[model samples]
Target: MKIDGSTVLVTGANRGIGRALVSAFLARGARRVHAAARNPAALEPVVAEAPDRVLPLALDLTVPATIDAAAQAASDVTLLVNNAGTHAVGHLLDMDLGAVEDVMRTNCLGTLRVLRAFVPVLERNGGGAVANVISIGAFGGTPSLGGYPASKAALHLMTQAVRADLAPRGIAVHAVFPGPVDTDMLDYVARNEPAFGDFPRAPVAEVAAAVLDGLEAGEEDIFPDAFAAEVGRVWRADPKAVERRLSGIT
Candidate 1:
């Protein structure tokens, strides 16, 4: 769906790619943007950009009640952006189980909860679009990512299934796979793991712009960065090769 004049809602809109998306949407002529975050206070700067068009809502994906409330409040939303996610750094077998579960809960189950609540809202608004901020990790596993990749892999399948189901209803479901982004999330990885300190990271604004461009072009699977595009092509050619490369097992 076109961003022009669309009423958009974005989750995790406090910082990183989420914040960038909110700005991009407004720049692209979105009529209104509901920026949802666990801490609505963190969204003040984004809301200030367009006081009349930006609505800051308290939404915690981990909280089902909040998701329902957001769905109710943002009923006129024509585009839904699921961008909240968590990550744990460690091997799956060696990482703290609690951390792994937290990643799964937020990245997988939490996303699902948001989708369930908003599907009806979108339908009521005459069938809008849903864009899920997935990751390149969804295609394979990395020894340092722990359960983050697994959760994203699950989300990938869910995106596809939901796309098929929603297509009949005129609701478009799109998945955006972005490689490492220059955000606080990547800063954490660089600080904790020196090995990835020099990894190429895409600018948050660039990635966000690509996502909006893809949506307008009717692309269902969007690679929003150069790294993501290359990785996606490799994986499509040979999944095992990409898996091996990610695992550092080649």
Candidate 2:
């Protein structure tokens, strides 16, 4: 789908990759951008910069009420960016069940919910695209991240399924697998394990630009960053080898 002049809805747009996505879309000439986050106030800076193009809305992916409310507010959105996610760091067996559930609900189920709610909007607006921000964790195994990796794996599968289901409707579904970026999630992980400092990190703006480029290219799966692209190459060659490498990292 063309990036310019499209109505876009970006979840978790208050900060990190989500915030970068909002700015990238605006820079790419989107007609409007809905900056959705748990606290709408967090989007003040983005709104301040582009008062006429950016709309701030309260959106908590884990909360159905908030999701529904945000969907209603962004009823004209043609592009949906599922960037909201939760991370639980620990061994799956030792971690809290609630934490695991939160990750799955936010990263997996929440994405689907937003898509379902926005399909009609996309259909009305000539069927645009939905970008689901997945991770290398979707294919790789890292014991330290616990259920977070498993949740991303579920999202990866969901992305494929959504593409198959939505293709007939002309709604393009693109899955993004980004390796360790210099986001707070990685920062927290790095604090726990200094070795993470050695892992390659991409700037959030670069990742966002890559995502838009992939969307414009009509790609089904996007590994926007170089590190993620390298990981994808290895994954395709040998899934087991990739798993073994991630196992060593954790």
How many angstroms is residue 95 displaced in model 1 relative to the true structure, after the best TM-score fit?
1.5
Best by lDDT: 1
TM-score of 1: 0.98
Tens-place lDDT digits, model 1, residues 1-250 = 8899999999999999999999999999999999999999999999999999999999997899999999989989989999999887887887799999999999999999999999998999899999999999898887888888899999999999999999999899999999989999889877876776877989999999999999999999999999999999998899998898777721
lDDT of 2 by residue, 3-38 (tens): 898899999898899999999999999999999989
Candidate 2: the clashing residue pairs are none
Give the TM-score (vs. native) of candidate 2. Answer: 0.97
lDDT of each: 0.93, 0.88
